[model samples]
Target: MTEIWNILFNPLPNAIMTLLTGMSLVYWLFTMLLGDGFEMGTDADIQFEGADVQDVDMDADTQADLETEQHVEPSFFSKAMDFIYVGKAPMMVLVTLFKFISWIVTIASSLVLNLAAFGWKSVLILIPVFILSFFLLHYVAIPFVKLYKNVGYAGEEAHEFIGRLGKMRSTIQGEQLGAIEVVINLDVIRLNVKSKDGSLLSYGDDVIVTNQDPNKKFYIVQKDINLNNI
Candidate 1:
């Protein structure tokens, strides 16, 4: 046990990789509990400031940089990132996979080579390890990339939910959010919703979608009106 711990932390390469791997583990734990709340979006968001950008305090250099950024072509580094399928999967997914692979390779090589004596010189080994990790990530991310492309990103069509009729999947009252199960064409759409009128509605109540919040975070709903009463 002492030998393993000593080898892992005493060496610079293993220690750096271990720290990255531990951080990745914490990231995955949070993701599992809160979904991909931290994912950097599947698409690139590179945008140059346009006419709409407020220019009240914008300096000449900042404007020049933005203009230059607009026409700048993709560099080899960006293309290489795409080639490795990094942008297709969740950024952290690729990062975690790469860090884990690097950690394992470093530890295994350390065990066989007694690399602990190398000290800071061992950090040089990370270059090759990084290359190998990305190679592995490319293959691992292929299927997932294909799947996300086909499924499309979530909430792409939330606008369709307005005026839809659905049944409460859980009790809701006042401003409390709850799940409502609706069918859009053939697919079941369950979403978090709040009562439009602060009315008490139970799990089995039928409801109609009224409107959406400005931010589109959740839908506003009210109890479905029965025509028989009128």
Candidate 2:
């Protein structure tokens, strides 16, 4: 047992093993802690800024084409392809692949170093590290990939709604107990809004979809011009 302990704890080999193990641990920890909350994926409508909403026609044929497309199940190989092809933010798959490669390299190198430095007895140290790596990869790394994907989808979805034109389905009055219903993406969303001038607006008032507050997750709207009057 003393001889086995010496082989496992030998200062020279343990130094390299510890460094690699610590690096792997830190990488997993950072992804788990921060990657989940951060957004990833492309905003489909990012380029439509400052353009008149009326000028941009929502093509029915294009919408129909998009709707008719079949959802294909991405094979493991295809997912890997996406990681390479689609280089978007919050790199979930790519980071995971890198971590996987790191683990492989770390374990292989550790094994070689251990064998050279301490022979077969070093297998004892390798066993525990291998087990630790497996648990960390499965529990920590996998969940982070899922979390980053979710955040990415949400960010992209929210971006789509920005600058969309909607009608005032209900009156938006700033008076006590006054609220407005706006049709956004054909969905009537109720909003508790105040006029920019702090005046009460009437029912069927034309309101423009303005800004969305991230912290409050609500829309900041403003009055729109009456086309009939214009």
Candidate 3:
């Protein structure tokens, strides 16, 4: 137990990775508990600013097609991120996975390196360890991404939840926040939600989805009148 504790928090390198790993684990647990709709990263509508413009004159169709291609083309950073299948999985999910794996590798490598080399600081070992871990994560996350891709909203399914009936799993104070469970294509999905009105909705309360804020990835919900009458 003492050794495990030391590996997780005592050493400087282990401490930093431990915090990252713990946060990542917590995010995953929260995502599972609340529903796959809780997002802690950027939304799909990310726009790349200041892209190079083409000055060639073309027909409307050709121009439109070129614009579409440009929009679809991943930026350099996004292309690099593809090594870890960024778009194939939720950002938080990917981050959590990478951090957890990095933490484990950091601990093991630190122990081994300490034996071979004396008087080396944990910080010095961190740079190389992190770079190696990132390379390993790039490959390791592929299969996991493929596995989870079908389970969550990888594409068009992201917007399918709109207009669906949702049941509150947690209380939502008006203008505050809450969580709700809804069924889509026979899959029970949980999503972060906010009341459409400034009213309190308690757990087990049935609500109706009125809209979705893509920027925040939260649903705007309202009390179901029919269910309230029951």
Candidate 4:
């Protein structure tokens, strides 16, 4: 038994042992901070009613009633993932935080291992380990995190009116600091608009534009009172 323990734990090749210890410590710290092997999938909760498998000749009314109750519930995980990649969470913050924590653990482990073994030469082995960990964490882990966010757990119907025109729900002004809700392709989209005439437009206004310019990142809207009068 003692021989087995010695063989398993013995630092026969001191350099390899130091590298293994550092790597193990890094894995422990990463899992403890981030999560258990980074979740990379999304799932959605859906509910269905009137699923009568036994009744082959079901009434049309009952079948229609069942269809009415069937609905899909969007998953929170998909939204969170979208926010990470498509939204505004900066990549620098994600990379820097993980790197900082990993480095702290690596450095501390190297010190502890050297102290226990009473060897000055073991310190040299840590340089390669640190470099490898840094590269893996930055290039590999960071990209995986972004990919998980982009792919999402479940699929989402693409917003069809992202590039179409929409009627402004409220007055859009040059300096106004609020969003406008527009109905496009039967979907409501909230967008920011800027005024080209340096004037404030009223609610139920029509905003027409061929393209969005840097000067007016929102919209340069014009009033369509004829449509509103109806």
Candidate 5:
């Protein structure tokens, strides 16, 4: 085990993989130990029937994933992520699998080539390892995506967001566009938004949707007080 850890941390590519996978392990450990008290991916809780927004714990990395969800630019990059079932399962989970697979491939290839740690042969080893990781990631994630859907997670249409209460994913002021997180049907969704009155809305500030732009440019929002807090 000591020799294994040494090799994993020595090579450049393997080192990166080890770091990412190590973080994933820590995240999963926290998720397991804390149970329902700690939800790594629950962005914002919403009560649609009574119309209320509630505070939920979320880490920075998961929040970043939600912020960019369904909003990635450049069709190719977006399509590539979709190809690997990114939206179906948690992005971080897929990322963890990708890195671990890459690390395994790199280490195995290095052994086959008799490449020394931090050696030139290990440098060449990265070429095929990087490519193989993607294919493996694509196949390995299939079961996870199905399992995620088994939990009844489904995204709703944008029109359903009107009159919904949510929290700001980023600061929005005046005409500048930003993101707001809302929950519907047990799925967290982020939509482009702008403060209705040109006021500054910072992250985690409660907001309610007033209306949506005619052309679907963005949602018009304003500060909202959570009734549950009163």
Candidate 6:
């Protein structure tokens, strides 16, 4: 067992790879546990609803897949991330997967290349290892995320959610915050909502999505006046 441990991660090079791989795994575990509470993919260019506007060409084939989500420009780092997946799942999940795969490859190569004995010479092996693993995963993630999106998990896009009916999950009184649950394409999703008119709404009151925040993070909603009349 000790021998095997050393083979996977012991020497300085292996130690670095193991650390990278471990960080990725730990992060994903936290994401799974924390769910939406944790912002795992801060670097991811895409969101659950759609791609950041400027980073995406908008004409790309993947854009057709999202059909209903909002569009916005992502940060520069996120634009680089666009080369990978376009956000079928949370960007955090994709980022973690990419790191996990790359780190594993880096570790494996370090062992096989026997860079442990080379001292400073290992840098030669490490540089190319990082580049190859990074790009390799970037290209591979596109198809994988696309496939994940296709088999269900459709229609939770921002564009489609706008104008959809949702029930307030909490009370909101004038410029305060609330949550709304709406069904889009038969899928129940939730969003942070605010009233357009600063009107008060009670829990379970019906509301309509009137607009989205500039950051596209949440919805601006209004109480459905006709709901009470009906």
Instruction: Give the TM-scores of the predictions, in the order they appear.
Output: 0.47, 0.26, 0.48, 0.27, 0.51, 0.46
Candidate 1, residue 195: the lDDT equals 88
Prediction 5 TM-score vs. true: 0.51
lDDT of 3 by residue, 1-230 (tens): 99778667756777888988888777668767977654422243431111001100123664464344333343465346556665455556667777877788878877876622433366566778777877888888877665554343332144355677877656657565565666544434456677887688876788988876655446688988894557
Candidate 3 has its poorest 10 consecutive residues by lDDT at: 48-57
Q: Specify the highest-lDDT model's number.
A: 5
> Cα RMSD to native, each candidate?
17.6, 17.7, 15.3, 19.0, 11.0, 13.2
Off by over 4 Å in 5: 36-74, 117-121, 154-230
Off by over 4 Å in 6: 35-79, 86-89, 120-124, 151-230
lDDT (10s digit) by residue, model 4, range 1-230 = 98544433333333345345556557657865876443321222221011111111224664354335323232464344333332212233344444554444445565456433745654465466555655455444556444533443111222322344555434445555223344433323344545556576555456553334344334344444455555
Clashing pairs in 6: 52-72, 53-72, 53-73, 54-73, 69-158
Mind giving the per-residue lDDT tens digits that candidate 6 earns over 1-230? Answer: 99878766655666776777788778668756867433323334345453233211223443443333323333555345445643334455566666667667767776677777887667566678667766787766776656544432322343356777887656676766556666644434546667788877767788988887887545788877793647
Clashes of each: 0, 0, 0, 3, 0, 5
How far out, in Å, is residue 185 in model 3?
22
Judge candidate 6 at residue 111 and give its lDDT. 65
**What is the TM-score ranking, best to worst?**
5, 3, 1, 6, 4, 2
lDDT of 3 at 128: 81
Off by over 4 Å in 3: 35-76, 115-120, 155-157, 160-230
